[model samples]
Target: MTDTTAFDWRSFLLNWSGEWADSLPGGETRSEGDEDARRARWLGFPPASEERIAAAEERLGRRMPPSYREFLKVSDGWRHAGGFVWLLAGTEDAHWHDNESGLADMFEEHLDEDAGPEERQEADIWRRGLQLDVESDITHVLMDPEDVDENGEWAVYTWASWRAAPPERHADFLAFMRDMYREFHSLRAHRRDGEPEFANDTTRKLDAQVAQARSAALRGDWERAGKELDEAKGYGRPRAAGLGDQIRRLLGQTYMVYFEGLVTDPRYAPELLPPLVAEHAAHSYRDDSTLTFHLRGAGEDLVSLAYATLERVRAGTYRYTAAGPFGTAVERARELARWGGTDEAWRTLIDALPLWEPLGPDHLAPLGWVADPVLGPLLTPERGRELLSTPRGGRTGEAPRPTAGLDPGGLAWLAEPDPGDNPTSYRFVLVEGAAPEELPERLADGNGGGDGDGTVLNERLTLWEARRRLLHGRREFSSYDDRALVAVGRAGSGWSFAFDGDPAAFDRRRFVSPAASASAGSDTRAVVVWSGLRARHGEPFFHLSVARGGAEQYAFTYADEEVRSRGRIPQALDPSRFFGDGEDGAEAERSLLEAVAGEFGVRLPRHAIVNGRLHTFTTRSWTRPPGDGETYAVIHLRGEADRPADDDRTADDDRTADDGQGSR
Candidate 1:
């Protein structure tokens, strides 16, 4: 029950005509080059005459609602992008069941099958419907007059042909309009945290470039505008698209490859434009906003759209739509990728960050998709796992692992060997009752005697809790100063070794990108780490550690991000990626080498693994080394195929942990 009087038709119309859509809801139908021309070139049909409006109502055997009827009188039909419509048919074109572009036709096709009892009852009359014209081919806006009552307002329902479930129901047209308005802004804005700021010089340069693009578009200069768009898109900002869209709308020429041999291979004996892709033609435009990748124009628009996704993803401001055409403009850029060839494909895969939805699953996940030559080469299956999983998991596990197969759409990964032990799962002990120097080599099985000082309790933990502690840090250990993290894993098939070190030394996230190796083939094996090492580079590899509290003792591991999050890690995620995390190939090599040895051993890499925060304790402080001495010495694990014999190191280097981090 919306208060109709509260409607701001003026505001709605002003926003609707935004740089496109040529009147319609933003204003009555207006042609391009009119007094107040903006970016869009599409036009709206002439308003319905009184007789025509009455005839439409008479044909339907029901009086038109006042508001909707008034709207139609302003513009009978429209061809536009942005405000939830691609084509708003006039009364003559409206139909109850025409497959090509009929709203009622779509409704019947997905009606009862995807509707609940109430919804089905409402659709039985087939009152009215409109297509949303999003990236996906099958979705629509429907109105049920049966339940309208004398108030003349009808509840609106959205039908997505891709959905096998009930259509989404909104209270009425106003509600639906509100939702579309929000989507419109979001599509244009992308990130809500505000436009990314540039440094003084970059800002001035980009601002100038954007103004030039705008100026060129205003004067109808497509060529100059495009070059400006090219330069601006290279930087992180949304303005580039807005400006380019303006120029594109002004040009008014879209070359659909199917209709025109634009990208056809001249190399082919019978050269022809690539085969038609009419399957998703519905995705070409937004009712009121300008289109990217629309009509197979210059693929640069798709490139800009894709790159924008990366900026938002890295900045931690991405949000998937509540109702997806299933895929986003960024996701749809894959088509643009193919249309534009290898370069466009590469650009889209990198910045678009295509997602995977396992068959039967409606939601998309960032990782676990099988390797695309471009995507696979660029990312690991676990690369953006944390960013994609919704509702987010706890920070209590060892780290997330690739839970599926390479072909994201296929179920082959399910048939593969379970990677066995997860790296994130750990059973460690944080000794609160003992000083850092007083704990035994085996804290879990300790005799329980140490130079007591401030150590007040012994907290043994499941790996999940251990992970939580690593992510959370010493917040819970504030009352007691000394703590030891005994991160555990099996080193060899025959013998298991525990990493006796400080929690401060273990960080799953590091500045150095671990060189990601090739993905694991079907034959790849999962090896256990008795907690002595993290794979080289980005991994939380293991090493022996010793910290000073009252006494000098070994500690285990923890995760730290490059940015200090204070606990909220996502906000601290790297704004720009520093790639490379030790890969599937490294794990395979380690497994093969271990199998070849067929013996018990553990070894250390050349890097020092210990990390800590320095505390300025008094000269007499028990945790400090009696005087102005540095923290305790960090030893190296003595075994495990020592390829680099000099790999081991002592804390003599005096290095420490960086601020923020992540999981697989």
Candidate 2:
């Protein structure tokens, strides 16, 4: 998609070659010069001192894991020190597509909930693949000459690294690790009062030695680092759990950096960078390094830069669509009008809106995430379009309201059918010409037939007209609410209602509403469903439409039972909260009770009850009003849990331990 007038697709492609640097021979090696520079740049960096490692180990009072020792050997070449990897959240399943060769089968299998055990296992493995993909979260630190010890015994030290935590916070993580180790050691004993001492005597000695060694290493002492590591291991301790793996990965990075430096080709860095960094970061749950380290190693590669830019743009777009403030304001405004709101809060929200000109020349995009019908007045149509074109972050979009307004005297209808008994019910009717004039045509003719004016279309047209008149002059004010419109349907046992299609079902045929059905003069199943002309039993309803070109049959697809049974309705539009309780049938009993208690201005008692039962409703539609007239209410729940016994004693013990650590 083009972003600005200056954007040209062809030019972009031509310029993209610079992004990849130079391709390696047989796609395995980079050119000589770039490789040499990268290696030199990383190797020139200083390695972590042995004394620092020793001191850190001393602080933890445990022998660090082998992996961790390996990591320290190459810590100097750590590429990235930024928190870029750690901040990336959420799984990347949506990125999969049909075009992926090996992954396509896996993707399709995952879509099938009823797939056999083998298929399910395959899908699970696929999920785990995505979950464990090194690129998902990682930091890379290349090894170099400076990473080795004075004796030429190479040690790993991060030089250029990905998956590095925020520079400021890295030290904090060390402290956190140390503290957690102490806690783990405390839990080893498992006394009657709970873990007063270390049950694993070996681990206790290792911890003390490692902590001291690390503390000293942090001060740039090398001689003591080896001594501490050796002494801690002598205590017959197993490897440290969390810290060990990281150390090992770091060591690997150091070795690779040294290896690459020895090699002349620059492509080696790029080739090795992506996978190595990815692997390291993956094992550590660090995501930021995946991007930062690669970028750093890549240097002037324009293709990589473009990709990075694209990622940034995409992230920006996502935030713009999903969590931006403007989108929130729009929704808030809608709620304000539906559920009564203080004028001051409303005005404050409006004033907070960033300035945007309506149809103005400025090229600014609308903030999609934050915009809603409630905040529509603050946004211009142009701005909205701009926001739609922006890239997405790792977040999803919120629901948008329907464009249509509410009509008064509106005859809202819902239909449900029982699967075991009767299956079909009247959904809606589309009549031609006029409502009254079209009714007689079907009944009088031997065949259910219609002329231009006598057709069932007339009846639906008449219904639409009547409803519009009742809802006339209803200017858009409130947000459109899909939740409130569900109850309006007449439901039986089996059939449920939906719009467009449902998402969770394995079969698209079950819920998809063919696009052609909604067009004028169309004759698809949607038209049939909307028309309420025929009541077919359980064999799923189908109809052919000729709106676009040639006619094609459309089917009433069954969606997942959950979506069909109880679609999520936002509580903001529930009428009983605004209108008095008992205004509806026995269903309004809770509202009635709440209203009665509210009159005395006293809070009601809160209780916890577990109602372990599952229920389903074959719903069609709900009785929700348009933005112009609907009301809403906000309900808040609050409570607190009592503390466990011996809380004071526990606190005292923890405090004493902390104090002892500080003194040491």
Q: What is the C-alpha lDDT of each candidate?
A: 0.34, 0.27
Question: Which candidate has the top score in lDDT?
Answer: 1
For 1-664, candidate 1 gives per-residue lDDT tens digits of: 5565457654555445542332223344544443233443324456789899888778767665555565566667545423346554566654443234444455567665557766555345344443333332355655666557456776666665556765677666666655654444434433334433223343456768876665443332446656776565544334564344323322332243222212221221011111111112224332313322333443554335434543433332333321133236334433332111222333343333223222211111222111111122222223333223211111111223333322221111211232542222221222222232332332321222222222222232333334344445221121011233432322222222223222333333321111001002222121122231343234433211222232322222223322221222221122112212533433433442233223213221100101111111100110211112223332233346533222222234333221001100
lDDT of 2 by residue, 1-664 (tens): 2112233422322222221122112234543543543434331123347676666556544333333343344332222122222111111111212122243353464466676754443333322221111121233211122222333322221111243321111112222222223333333322333322322334555777666554443222323644565444333233222122212222232332222220112333322233233333335443454444334433456335334433433222211221255446545544432211223223434333332221111112222222121222222343332232222222123323222211111112122122332213322222222222222332222122112222222211112222343235432211111111010111111111121111111222222222232222433212222212113423222221112221223222222211121222224323324234223222232342233223212121010000000011112111222222223222222235623222222222323211121111
* Weakest 10 consecutive residues of candidate 1 by summed lDDT: 613-622
Runs off by more than 4 Å, candidate 2: 1-365, 368-403, 406-411, 414-664
- Residue 325 local lDDT, model 2: 59
lDDT at 627, model 2:
25
Give the best candidate by TM-score.
Answer: 1
Kindly report the root-mean-square deviation of model 2 from the true structure over all alpha carbons: 30.4
